[model samples]
Target chain A: MSPKDLEDRLVLAIKRAETQLPDDVVSALEKAHEIEEGSAKVQIEAILLNIKVSRETGAPMCQDTGIQTFFIEAGADFPYLGKLENIITDAVKRASSEVPLRPNTVNPFTGKNPGNNVGRYVPYITWDIVKGEECTIHLMPKGGGSENMCALNMMSPGRGIKGLKRIVVDHIVSCEGKPCPPTVVGVGVGGGADLSLKLGKRSLLRDVGIRHPEPHIAELEEELLELINESGVGPMGVGGKTTALDVHIEYAHRHPASFPIGIAVQCWADRRATVKITKDGRVEVI
Target chain B: MATVKLNTPFDKKDIQNLKVGDTVYITGKMFTARDECHLKMLELHKEGKDIPFKPGDMALFHCGPVVQKKDGEWRIVSAGPTTSIRMEIFEDEFLKTFETRMIIGKGGMADRTLAALEEVGAVYVHYTGGAGALAAKAIKKVTDVYWLDELGVPEAAWILDVEEFGPLTVTMDAHGNSLYVDLRKEIEKNLEKIHAKIENS
Candidate 1:
């Protein structure tokens, strides 16, 4: 397909990711509503209504259209191997204006907003090269509230999994109603600082209620979900039974001396979309 | 437990009457100021320069809304509350200097902020985080904006006309009660039980 075709498809993908709350997240939120009362219930009701209105009107789900984050898996033989980056950048530019995405990127020191959502390395992309002929691109419009709650800790290997739990829970406990409770918690264990955080963020793309393939990791995720919800942080941190709807864990092999843990999160809006481009140039949203 | 519809420029009594957990809907004149504007406001005051608007008894929001221009006019695309804790350091001084009566933000603020709210007879209202579209429906228009060039669009102080603009919960009240502070303590007391269960699982 032409570069413009790819750009247009990416624009639609961004708009969809920005406006539509995924089905699994909505379902999980509905369950939280059933189990909550008072301010918690009220907040959930507003969230549900907000999702409905955003979907119907095609407005953004959150004001913080967030930093556009893309995860791409391209087959080594894909035709646009070298051009994918430029194509995605063009897509982000059009989406920034057409989806009318909130330009959240600003210079860290100067605080200058380029206003186009394209800054040096802004619409950050992560790549994984595989052996297929097709490519899959996933976009997540991550809001700032939950993103602000992300934390990192370097621990003594002696601290073990127990020490790991302490830091992660302590972080979320302080978060309370701040990170938009009933959140989807993402935990990355073992990788160094940056890689751990990356794993934590990427793990959030998994569907709600899904677990790791490994039993131990799945068990850890299940336990944290219950424990976080037990904190009484409830909805909007006002006070209720559920603080988090789910927890996801992703891990990597680590040095015997190093154990770095990372925590990230997504609010109930949990907006993300995926698209597939065929070798024949057909761009289809999956 | 009660619901109140407040018009801005509200006095001490209007704020003090509120208790933690009471829901409020604000109407009338309000202003927007976030990270940059707060710091700038403080700096300007320190330099003996006057602020752009009357903050006394006014409403302030911790938001950076998404706005666009069409026909040479500003339009709101998405406007949602940002986390409030980042502003905690400047909040006490801001509340005292501005004499602000109401704050609408997402996260519950810290002790410093809660204490300042008590002294200034103000309240910290918690709205649903990321519910930008719902909040947008209540915002009728942007009446005026300031500091666009310097602070950029998101960080600029946007004077907005909002009508019945909340189901905002009073997490921190002028009566010296804070839902956040109290709840956190209770959670800490219960943490031992949690630790025992999750210990090495």
Candidate 2:
């Protein structure tokens, strides 16, 4: 209800996201570890061990604690909407020092770090409004290595879904080990260039293995996942059976002439956490 | 398949003996160097100025760590490898100029780095990506730090002492062998088939 209460809850949510892998992601990785062999198996084992150490010590899972990003779904009637931005920013500052997030934000021109993880438009927030009495916040701390692998393609509308599949497959293959496979591939189709990329990144917020409601879109996700894994860019790209843990696709209606495809890749760590807050000040973090 | 244990100030023979896929654990001293640290080190080399530490005596890690100062000591909270390919442009000269024998990072480096490894009798090992906690556990102490003010924490060169610090896999070797190169070729071949499957479907 109050700004301090909300900020404190956000800080704890960030700490959870940093130190613990979500249940879905952890289970998917466990499955990969069981199925892989040879060098790929070894890499997965190290990753599992790392996950254990991170959870136990409450240390960040990755050194690149990532640029802080929050996806907020707020009820139009939620009383604290006006103060949400400031509260979220303050939470980031506290989490940067307390959870000890890497100071990832830097001035593009001056190359100076304020060292608090707050800078021009950082702790980037994406907001959605709906009719409800609760605000739900999702934190996805995206690492730099995989973030660098994001790609966008503008294709002729005539190219169709086949062309989309080709472009996505080609991009992931070219990325090789750079994005840190076993990665989660998020593909955004049909939107304008910027919207496509945004949708692609937002699609990563979905839990691994959950399919889209539409049958056709769900099928596309399965096909893309199969093709990517078949590429043999396995765990950390050393070669294995599982190149990607999952593939997620989100789409929007396109203009007559242009089809833009955006690819957002997330590494194996795939750190994300969700918090739900009610108008009465009750908070729950997952 | 074999596991090798290496200490700092590695002998050329120890580096030369490694091949792709061999797991390695390292001990002794190392320095964290990321984009700015690499650039600054190269610039210092060009100016013929003294470097803060001896490159040949320590392993170079491509890392930007989360650190905290507690009780008057710098502590590594999470220290994992950054993607190595970003440093591809500087690595060849870095290896030749400093004769650094080992590189620890995630992802992989390019041909120039592989060639430099062959020429310099060095190897590039991969610490698992996102395994920062595991890495910090192996680091025994922060010996010193350089360029803290100029480059900030992640970009600063933090000198560290570590013990048996790795499940690092030798991905690039002094004999001009690279596991990444091999994987890329295989993936490319598979991509063609995947494209065909997409076309037919």
Candidate 3:
């Protein structure tokens, strides 16, 4: 509840984020490696090796350390609400310099910046208030390369599966080497613009091999995966069969005229970590 | 085999002898620049200002490094390669103006860029992206910097002394071979087969 405790928690969260790759992501990458065929097998192998090298050296997983994004779910009774926002901003500033993450945040209009954490809309923080007395934080270091490949649309429900497939496959194929494949494709369906985009990003947090709980959505995931691989946008977009490592989809209810779908492509590094803090002042790294 | 140094304006003989997957270690004055600097250089070229270094036979790394200052001098923080496709627009023209023979970056370019390289006898070398710390170790010294007063550290041109600077692979060679494009095609064919099997299964 105090400033010191918040600072320590912030520092701990940042370090945990830096050191450990998420278990779900790791598991997914392993599965991808297991089923991977073609020259892409080597790329997957190299990516796994890169994870090792990055961890051992304490360097970032990719040269593009990505824009720091935090998905924070906090309880109403959480002690540090008043000071938490500034604490997070300050922590991001400290971590950017200390973790020495690549200065990915830039001034969109001016196209120039201090090359530090200070920027408009930087360290983009998305928050959700909940009932519990604890807080959970999810950090994803999103790289520019993969972010470039993200796409969205409001499809006609009549356009159906075929239409959905066309947009996703085309966007990825067009991206080619830009997003640094073999990528993990995150698909969000049903929600409104912001929610659809959020679902697309949150879908990335799902472990690689796991499918949507709904069998039909999972089937769509599989089908899209096939369609994308068939496009021949292989590892590093060098024209391989393994255009995507996995495709995870999440959905919500949408307006009658809307079938909003968002796609967020994650490069191989897929850096993410989670931390939970309880009311008893215990911190758990997930 | 271990190390070699060469200056710009390489001849056809030099270009022909070089092959894909060969490791090259370059010496003699090299400049450190990335996307912004490249854009600025092109603008300068258009306006007919004195070019920084003769472009030929030099390595222009695709990087925007992090830097710090100590004792009133700029120093590198982490200098790693960025994906080169972001510079796709400027490369071909830049190649013609600068007699640069060795092009170092990650990912190979498309047909137009490749054509320019072959015409100019330039070799496109792929450095391991994300190896900023490792790459920084190769920069033996920082000689001088240009545009420092205006552009600031990471964005400025860092004239460097490099030794054994590369484990570079010729992703696109002077002979019109591109490992990345070729590899992608090979991967695509196999993927098609796998998809067919999945559909049948």
Report per-candidate DockQ.
0.68, 0.84, 0.28
User: What is the alpha-carbon RMSD of candidate 3 to the true structure?
Assistant: 4.0
The candidate that achieves the highest TM-score relative to the unseen native structure: 2
Candidate 1, chain A: TM-score against the reference: 0.97
Q: Model 1 - which docking category?
A: medium
TM-scores for candidates 1 onward, in order: 0.94, 0.97, 0.84
lDDT of 2 by residue, B77-106 (tens): 999888888899989999999999999998
A134-177 per-residue lDDT for model 2 (tens digits): 99999999988899999999988788889898899888988878
The top-ranked prediction according to DockQ is 2
Per-residue lDDT value at A131 in model 3: 99
Task: Supply candidate 1's per-residue lDDT for B196.
Answer: 82
Point out where model 2 deviates above 4 Å: none
Chain B TM-score against the true chain B, each candidate: 0.95, 0.97, 0.87
TM-score of decoy 2: 0.97
Ranking by lDDT: 2, 1, 3
Candidate 1 lDDT over residue span A1-286, tens digit each: 7777888888999999888888999999999999998778889988988888788878897898888889999999988889989988888888889988887778999867777788888689999999978999999877777888899988898989888888888788788777777788888998788888899999999999999999989998888888777777788888888888888999998889989898997887788999898878789975
Ranking by DockQ: 2, 1, 3
Indicate the worst ten consecutive residues by lDDT in candidate 3 chain B: B1-10
> Using alpha carbons, what is the TM-score of model 3?
0.84
